[model samples]
Target: MPHVEWRGGTCRVKWWTGETLPNGRKRYESKGGFTDEDLALQHGMDMEYEVRHGVNITNRDGAMPMPEWLDAWYASLDLAHRSMVNYESVIRVHIKPYFSRHTVSEVSIMDHRAFKRHLADVLPSDNSRQSVLAVFSMAMEDAVNAGLRKTSPVERHRRRGKYKKKKRERKKDMPPGAVETLARNAHAVFGPAGYAFMWTMACTGMRPAELYGLTREYCYPSWPGSDLRADPDEADRYAEDMLRYGKGDGLLPAIRVERQVQYKDGGLQFFPPKYESSRTLVVPPFLAEMLERLLKEHESRWVFPSISGGNLRSANFDHKYWRPIADGAKEDEGPRRPGERLALPEVPAFAGKRLYLIRHGAKAWLDEDGHSRFAVESRMGHEVPGVEGVYSSMTVPMERAIMKSQQERWESLPDRLGDAIWG
Candidate 1:
């Protein structure tokens, strides 16, 4: 039962919370500042109901500081290395400075509101502010679970329009004939291995990290046999090879995308692909032939290794090779300032495009071929929601359709680029 009384020109409700201390002292909770007795009593009854439903209301003494709680909560999380890196960055740069000294219970709704205002003023992008707020909210939720606070202040702030809709960004995709042009130019500028790498990405829709992770062991090509055909009964053999060699191939040389290379802790690290997008994608026959040639020439373990026979880093490749080829040549002008010179270059039609646009173009090609939604999504490593995703598997017909469509695209490249590609 809850009772309301008039106090300081406002109504206050008193209620007994079902909590006891070490010394057998019962805890009573109170809420104040209601305009009338009815409202105060109603709020009190709700609080009492929450207490009866096993909500912890004992630790409201502002004892556990936020920094300590955040550290413990972070340590307990079983997150990926990349996700953990983002969490650590948010905690150190945005969260700790503001809330480190304040106890969990002292962070009231008003304080949360103030923090949002501060974030709006200081942060340049809405996405950054939202990310910080999200991590802070998670930390507060952990505090509530630990009996350090009665309720999360973030929940109250959420109801007051803390979240606003952001303008969606338009997807960047390459135009028609762009992929073939880029691949032709890449071969001319960078060499045969670069040509194979670019064509493989465009044909298979693999992420840059996945491309970096490709190895000879994961490449299943129908080579050493001139007909480029796999034995009809080789599926079981391939499965056994996968168990022994960590990667196996089918009749057509398919690439198994089971891992990705990421930069962490000042070095490179290999982890499972994003969202565990582990699937084998059938390669276009012509592209498969090119990859075989590349492997023989390189004589390295990796399917696409750097000049030094090491794992290729996307950043280094982009800055040194991709930017120059995509953007074309530049001539430096006279100095505009004491230490600066102006360089003007004739930009190509696809100047600002990124390597990722090639992957998007691959998906566009699949969709244009009228493949089933499940096939497209699975090939792109996207999880389709609902029963369709769980019940459906990529069938042989789907893989064949994808392979045929991609092969057609590869065969048409010479016509699209004329002498630039065929020469």
Candidate 2:
């Protein structure tokens, strides 16, 4: 609503600015010096209408420079550490560089498309470009809510699945044999911890963060017992409750996934699993024994700490440990010296594939076993969408079936009792 009042014998127009003052009064923008009261009243009404309709760019925070807005918006976000990192990268590397001279409201649709083209030229894949653009679109949409822009320049119709492009190749699961091969390779590189780490992740379908975050208390046949609570009796009771009441085999080993690790502020930090999907995963008999052995031999709080004996940094592990295991260690520079040749042949099954594929492989194995969709997805730390997720549940039969299938797969492998590949 707008008001016209006489000020110093001239008409003045005032309207609420859609903001409240510090004193809890309505903030207003006013213009004076109109000799005609009706004219002043009309002008105030027009301004009010524009403000109400989101056509007024003069509102608070509407004209901030793009770079400043980007920084402020980023600082205000409460997101996952990894997601924040990606957003920061997209803004710093792509957005701020191009839109540095513009205000939040000044990026037109043409500019948005051009910025996308620029990203296409620089980013390696369509997915990369899309991810970056999604970040920018989110920022612009937020700007509109903050009265920084009337509308986002990013077109919603251009988003993912708006048009079909190409069908992606079906990813293959790592069979028991391939998993063993990777374990052998990991053993050669990281010793027993490496061997067990590969097997644990492959068998459990654990995300890299989840696997890195694994601790002894979460491991089965041992968990709740390994808990370091001050009250030992409480732990004992909890253990009894968990062990005494399940179907199939009450003694079946399981891993309770309560948290995951990620790099935050230059240090490793524990966070709830993605989407807050804290779940307990059941493992096969062989995996249960494997994890128990690994825990016995494991020295650190982490099931698989980095070679430096600290919390595992994903990047460092990927480069130093995983790369050699998957791609095989090439001849080190010492090869140039007289007798310092050192190399490890890469595993063909994992050639050029990322470590996360191990999770994919595990999920694939569960699906191939023809278990209940809910059980499979739940075990993989994913929620089945829609009402199905609400009604469907993991039963003891489903869990037992999964365990049986995996054990059978293990039994099918040759050389099941072979000597260790590496010390």
Candidate 3:
């Protein structure tokens, strides 16, 4: 049995560790801060039970330095080389400098708050600070499990909790004809192919990876083969339209978005679209005609291929074409010198915006037209939520409405730009 004894004013609790030392003595542990004998006795019994059950716990009088614990914890991790390198970088740059000499058991709540304040000064944004804090907290959790400390000292918040939101103006979506403006700039930069690529991405709201991976097999004017099944109620209507589409006389055209090109094992590979959302996106009539022309003009497998006739890597495309098209390029300030090229004016709508914003712009356009939520979400490769999503399905009428609205938006472009596109 564990025991409690009064050594003058304060009482101490003692417990056997259920271990035997090399010298043939029983191993014991003790704590001596309790003033009440009854409390000390209860604590003694609890400690003895825990020790007998082999439950490892904090050593109140012993310590392990944070740096030592972090190194040990990292060494014990079995992770992919890339992931391990990332963790090591965070530990070396953000963690070790602040808590180098502190003990695992002595890192209190105040230290955590102080570290956060330090991070706020050193890190550029809240997200970056949180990411670093998460790495440190993960290490602290391992330390606790290793019995270097009783519990993690790092503060935690509910995943969705926000203490204070940063106040900033919402960015405006690209307006109706802004896509055409980008398409025009692209044409000026890389000729007809660039123009076609920009129009396709803007019109379909396809992710850059998905667009880069687009091949002849999945594009419009040829996809949605005759084998496609329509809702039973609309079977007759679907059959007539599909027959016409196959015969090259129909209005509806679609793209089957299945796979995207991504980097894996240091090489390009095909993976399912984000969230594995294999879908068919309807296209505007103008875009359909444009894609038809472009495909007929090229025999390559990809709908859009780089000069090397392979996948369009983002780094190369962005630097050589996208940036010049979006941000414009020219001499800094003085008069043009010899061998100086003429300037390219920045596309105002996309001057400081990202390429992914085009997807968001497409969504805004669909929503502005008051299309059904199911149809809009389906077109955007998003899964609708709640019972409505579970029970509802995209129908022929929904697709037709989307096509009509998109065609209208395309036709509304000014003749100055419209003439340039067609001519």
Candidate 4:
């Protein structure tokens, strides 16, 4: 039993318990006992709080093993299968081996410093550190929520800076001509499968996941209370009619956000788009007609169905197909500047280019064609947070108008800029 005694104006507390700690040594938990009763009482209160609340009395107090706490945290999480897999992967590959034996509450400033140093010194890439930090923060948050610690130690850490390459302004975006040439080449290489996929991405700005998730059931032909174009052949005429009469005196066309498709569970599940606002977009006659054509031609229940008639894997689509096609086209197109000196004389002319160039091309066209940021960001489904989100909704109609105009600009590119990029 621990003992406490007061003598004169001083107080002394002693630990007489014979228990050994994990390191197989006795712990007094105190030394040079308080000379005042008030200080002694406060220490007693702190000790009680530590016992009841599991709060770390000090950073080096040695409460529980890091691996044990991490395991408990993992077991408690109600997360998706993919999310759990990712979390387990990060903990196993990064956190466990380094921190497993360390006591959770006893982890010192030195340990943290070492962790940061290890990340900086030996991490294969900047993203590896970022991923580790993300998992560490999550686990620490769990500790706080469970009342295991007063606050997250992991919260005290931050990445030094964004990756250096990320800090640089991205290269100038590809022009529309280059995008079409690539699309044309993609069509030639993969036939309708590639052409349709590229065109859908270009027109909708939908992510690959969203493209793969598109279900026929979610494709709505008519906006609310809007005229239904039952005949796909007359969609163009119907679009013109709506433009002329849907709004008073044909002054401004009635916005017809005709259809949308969404993916859930990374495209394993399909659903209607949640981002749809009350506002609608005015799609052009050509696009409406194109959609009509696509709907008529494709018999599958998916707009952009997978090769196996299921959702397409994003990696397979990009690597097995997109890269090869883009690289081949780049080879056929020759060097960006004729006889341009390059580091890899042996690398095929197309070896270094990325499929992301298609996305960049669309953005460049949208910006150059005078489309507003609101329009582009909305089309891209970027959820700008806080006040920007409100402003986007208020100004989204102008964005729709700009997008309509941009689409017109895209339609014209294949003819005007065809030779500039392809030749």
Candidate 5:
């Protein structure tokens, strides 16, 4: 029962919260500063109803501040170093300042909605806003689970449709020949390792992080006999070639994508591939040869070490090596424009494209080759949904088919580029 009493021209409602401490102390809560006695009594009754309905309101009156709660929540999480860094950035930059003074109980659905609107107005990209909101929702969910709130205020459903539509409009896949051109140019500017990196990613559908994680030990020249098809003659020839090349007979050429590298804080950190997408992918012979050459020449342990003999950072690589080649520049090749200094020529075909397009190109190539959806998804480190994903495994035929398609692409590259690849 809730009762209101007048004190200093204000009405305060008092109620039993239906809880007791271990020492047998009854727990009660009070809400004060209401001008009307009836209103105060009604407020107290509403809280009592909430508690009766299994909504924990023990801290209703003394809810922890958002910043303090966020810090506690962050400390309790068991996330990877990279993920922890990202979460910290989001909390520091977006969430903390906005919700710092507010108690967990003070934030409502309306407040969340306004925060989202504010994000839309301030953030440059939809992805950024969504990421921040996702972190916020996760924190609020923790709050709800910890009994700090009755429900999460995040309205994910309200934003899903808009996000989906925007995703469709954004770049999905690369145009044909764009990857080959990029690779040739990359080779010219950044050398053989750059070319090998581009080709492997284009063919393997490996994420940038996965590419960075590649090691000499995990990279094989071929698949084992058990995983290969029952073509003894072909296997014999492959074995002979492997023996001649000093590579072991049992190992077939493949890349083991078990981990990924993420640049966090001030250095590179290694983490398991996203969604535990750790699987082996067969590499075409040409790519295997290229990787072999790269490994033999480079003294570093990483298959694709940066120019400074360190872990490859995606941002640094993009800005330094990828952009100049992809976008193009005349670079002191003499002036062409009248009354102008030096001419700046652009690679029209490569301009406005991104390094990530290589991954898209790989997906497109697989789809075009008519590979099984499961095999493609598996190769790309994506989880196939439902029973099909659970039961399905990459079969010999699927592997051979993908390998054959990639082999053809590799064989045709020289003809496609003619003189550009060497120059």
Candidate 6:
């Protein structure tokens, strides 16, 4: 039997049993000295009831604390080391600062809504809001799983604030001349390194990270051994290898995208592609020629190797390479011709001028070259009605048509840019 009682100004608990504990002593606990008789008696009675009923009174508070539970939950995730690190960073940076004081049970929907609104207001970038919310939701899910609360306030917040559904509007892709200008500007401003980089991106339509991870083995000539004529089965073997690496076919011949290069722990490393089928993209004739030249000249295995002979990190590429080219390409809209200026239609000052002229560039090229939405979509790796959007399963005819259209548009690029390519 065990009981609680008043002892002086405090409560005392006492228990008695016939059996001994592990120490081989008689089982008896008592509060011999008690100043508050009532509390002592009540405590004694409660202890007696607990012991008689075989109830556990200790360790009820051992339910994990919110912060401790969050830590444990974070550790359990099998995410990429870099991804896990970033998630923890987001918690420390945004979530912990505000929610640290409250237990998991104390957070309500109102609190979550307020936090969301505050984040929306303070964080100007939409992407930042999404990132912060993801971390917040993960932590709240952990709390719910631990039975700290009825439900996660974060789940409610996310459900309520899901992305709005709208008519699927096609993105305005870069105009026909724009990529060529980008290439020319890259060359004129950045020289050989910039030219090659921009040309590769424009021609392949591979994301920057995809290009950065390219290796010599993935490039043409060597794997197939240069002589497209000498080796009868070279192209087929290349195509087969390309398929194993997730390519639809040998459409992108010059350089294939087997993987991506990502920054982890502040260093460049190879990672799986963003999508499951990150395969080879057939290079156009002009770009393939350019790649062949680069491959022949550069001894490094990386097709688009950084100065460090490793994957080109985003920060380094943007600051050291891309920014300089953008800066050098800074040009003012030259003075409008007198006749053209006078011909321009006038509108009320309050009405903002629309940039309808921009769409015309892409539209004109597509129309002139007999390109359909499918062609444009294919070239830009856009999601089709039945496909995963970016990576197509097999569309040889479609891909070829798209490439031909893009080539025409690219060739029609302004001479200013074309002349900038020294070689």
Best by lDDT: 2
lDDT of 1: 0.71
After superposing candidate 4, which stretches have Cα over 4 Å from the reference?
A: 1-62, 75-85, 120-123, 155-169, 220-267, 271-285, 329-364, 391-400, 414-423
TM-score of each model, paired residue for residue = 0.72, 0.80, 0.70, 0.63, 0.82, 0.63
Q: What's model 5's TM-score?
A: 0.82
Tens-place lDDT digits, model 4, residues 1-423: 345678766676654223357998865554335787666766655665565554534333346688888888888887645467678888887788889777776555567668867878868666678778888878877766765566666535356545555433245445445555555554444344445566545555555545565544333243222444544985675665444323233333223333343334555453333343212344444444444455566577665544444445533666655564565533434222223222212213223565554555556656776666766666555666677667654253564565476567567764732233222
TM-score of 2: 0.80
Query: On residues 132-204, what C-alpha lDDT tens digit does candidate 3 reach at each position?
Result: 8988889888777777776788766634345687744345677766677677666665445567788777777
Off by over 4 Å in 2: 1-48, 51-55, 59-61, 158-170, 227-241, 244-249, 330-343, 416-423
Q: Which residue pairs show collisions in model 4? A: none
Poorest lDDT segment (10 consecutive residues) of candidate 3: 331-340
In model 6, state the lDDT of residue 37: 61
List, residue by residue over 1-423, the lDDT tens digit for candidate 1: 998888778988888888777899977878789998888888888888878887645445447778887888899988887788889999988788888778878998888888988899989878889899998998888787877787888855235545657755345555445666565555544456556777788778999888887766567553222221244665664564344322145455567776788888788887888888877687766666677667767676667776556776743777665665566544343212123223334225457666676787788888889999998888889999999999998776777778788877666654643234333
lDDT of 5 at 372: 89
Alpha carbon lDDT of each predicted model: 0.71, 0.76, 0.74, 0.54, 0.73, 0.56
Clashing pairs in 5: 221-252, 221-253, 222-252, 222-253, 223-252, 223-253
Cα lDDT tens digits for candidate 5, 291-338? 777777778777887655666675377666667667765653321122
Displacement of the residue 385 alpha carbon in candidate 4, Å: 3.7
lDDT for each residue of candidate 6 in 157-193, tens digit (9 for 90 to 100): 2355467764432334455444454454454433444
Off by over 4 Å in 3: 1-46, 49-115, 130-163, 224-251, 331-342, 416-423
Name the 10 consecutive residues with the lowest summed lDDT in model 6: 342-351
Worst 10 residues of 5 by lDDT: 334-343
Cα-based RMSD of the predictions, in order?
Answer: 7.3, 6.1, 7.0, 9.7, 6.7, 10.2
